[model samples]
Target: MGFPKHLTSAIIRLELPKNDGGLILTKNLYLSCDPYMRSRMSRSTEGSYVDSFTPGSPISGNGVSRVLDSSLPGFKKGDLIWGVINWEEYSLIKDTSSLIKIQHIDVPLSYYTGILGMPGVTAYVGFYEICSPKKGDTVFVSAASGAVGQLVGQFAKLYGCYVVGSAGSKEKVDLLKNKFGFDEAFNYKEEQDLNAALKRYFPNGIDIYFENVGGKMLDEVLRNMRHHGRIAACGMITQYNLDQPEGIQNLFLIVAKRIRMEGFLVFDYCHLYPKFLEMILPLIHEGKITYVEDIVEGLENAPAALIGLYSGKNVGKQVVAIAHE
Candidate 1:
């Protein structure tokens, strides 16, 4: 209701594990601050994919780490890996199965916490798997300057689609148009009416929507969607903090417009990680795809960095760099 508090920092002593039945001890390098984490700060209902972070507990999220010790098969000391780890300096990862041993270290390791990790997968699956497109499809992305949204727009462009994106500030909108090469970009905050803005951008009606911010944006999008338009509901950042969620009065457009709206979790698409890396790594190196990261230096700034996400304070992917090596 008032100001919210997320875990900041704590001092914890670490010990090398005795046995190695696939248990790995790693030093945390970088951690991710994402919109979904906000939902965990509150009490979630049954069947939620992730559980709420308990108070006084070391909060866990996607991170890139250097293996300090690993008695497990296929893992060894000094191997760089990225996966789920606690928000701490050193972490003892018990289950190494889900961990991704870093293959390409040429790119920034902190990228593993962002563009090369969970957020990247979310954009890939949501756009490619869910929002199947043909050339010249009229695409729109909400929160377009974000980590995932930026990638989505670029992916659509590379696939030969005309893309438009909406952000909250002039700077982000500029990044979308100039840096990301979106056909058009707008600051949603400056718009008096969202539906009018969508219409202004998509005069022919939008064919695909890569949704990041939901609620009113979704409702406005529904009104301007073309027949058989596809909506990839990646996240609802706008509704995450509201005590009462904003109801979409235009949901009936799903039937009227014959629209396909689908929601997906990145975990379900983990099997495609190798495939994703194959596609993104090449593009990243070739300069065909570009990524932006907003990283803070220390764990002490982690809480503010994370909380800043809600207000769109960060320009791109938000990361916390806990250590150098």
Candidate 2:
């Protein structure tokens, strides 16, 4: 009945495979568990940018790794990198296209899997590119304590926007307000009427919405959006596992309010990685921006950590530590 049921681990001999060319061997330090990976678990990923996982093969995701051996010219031995890697202690990456060398190591190596890696870029592109935010804008973020959501809220606050976020628990709500510096935050689970909750937060109307949780929450957000408002559709974690996803009732409001709802993929905006790092790295060092991670140690426990995202078990970004470098 749960995602954990579908996952099983097996042990193989600690041996290296013959590298013909363009392959790099790595010792995976940390693995990321993202909500989007749930879609990749399906047998068919018709139009998805990412391929479906092979039934009996290792599930791959973004991770921080130390290169042990390399047949590629760009990567050398002991070069730290972050990119698509397998869910194991060691991985032989056949595709070197996705990998990026990590130049900055002052921060935790595990941070390459969250704050300094994919989620960080996602927040950057989704907010800055997709949602054209301005100062004094009323911004709302759903699932705001998660990897991308937390960063989006903080970015909005730093940009002089009035930010509010909704999470599943009081602990995460408090983290959003007190830690991430959101103007206000509330627990969506405790709200009887989501539309009323949005009304309470934004009496005028929402100018920008960083959507992570879709379904009822999105429908409510549509009704409370201001004219010419923008919405960055980041992820719909609520609909990932459903056979029939819920439909939004207020989509008609998109036309009525002149709402700009756009969906984005991190890969599309990868050319801006340097720009993102330039902005985020300084904030991180100056302590102007903060990140929270719910890391579970050991590769064997990775399945449980990934499954925890759906039930709101993780308080922040969920990461699996395979081996520290």
Candidate 3:
């Protein structure tokens, strides 16, 4: 069995509770199916940031929902919010601290599940805060066609940096170079020698490396970093499934290059969401920024959609659309 084996059945249904005491019942509109969710599928969530998904229990992740019934003071019925929500149609959220009420409806409601929500904030904090790029910096992004990487490449370009991205397939490489406007990009799977491939694109060495697929790619990247280069260690999908995580042979470069490598969680930067949205929404409105979502129509397909992430099946941001506005 892959990460999630249980068939998410269509028969499993739940409606909003008529009354809630110190809780809010909501109708889940969109569910985010991401690689990170696999960490929760394990029997134990030890060493994992989020709690594990208990078997036979409702699985929850970042979602956009409509408040149906509320016994809380700040929340009211019919209000729109996005936060940790269950895989089912309706859910009762007791700890309301993580939730955010949707303020801007001009954009698509489903955006709250991807670019406008956690993944957006993730890219924002990782690039601007962690990477600390300067104008004319040479940047590289691995797995660049996904929800987060595409935005990072665009952000680097907006900062007047030369960006190169890598993906597993030709279609994604084309998306990076042609659609996302990356100066250069390549299909990593096609390259026989990753180090030489990186050298071809980044002749002067990478000033900022957005670390997505970690393992072999990271090993090659460490060899090509400029002095004082920064690496924002995002999700390392390559090491996630391995029985023993691959060791990087060239970590000595960190000391030699004075590189700063950091890992971040979107929650720590939640306070900056408003600022992030302000910068992105205008770009979106002016048609300067664009996002793509591969949405599965119903909840039942969530299992397959989530597992497909590891296989690189979904094209863009993988969103499980539950209910419409």
State TM-scores per candidate.
Answer: 0.95, 0.95, 0.94
Model 3, 49-160: lDDT tens digits are 8888877777788999998878888999999999888888877788988899999999999899888999898999999999999999999998788989999999999899
Q: Global CA lDDT of candidate 1, please?
A: 0.89
lDDT of 2 by residue, 1-325 (tens): 2354444556643444565657777888999999988878776656467888776677889999998878778988899999898887877777888889999999988888888999999999998899999999999999999999999999999999999999999999999989999999999999999999999999999999999999999999999999999999999999988888898888999998999999999989889999989999999999999999999998888999998999899999999998876
Two-way lDDT contest, 1 vs 3, winner:
1
What is the full ranking by lDDT, best candidate first?
2, 1, 3
Q: Native-vs-model 3 lDDT? A: 0.87
Off by over 4 Å in 3: 7-19, 43-46
TM-score of 1: 0.95
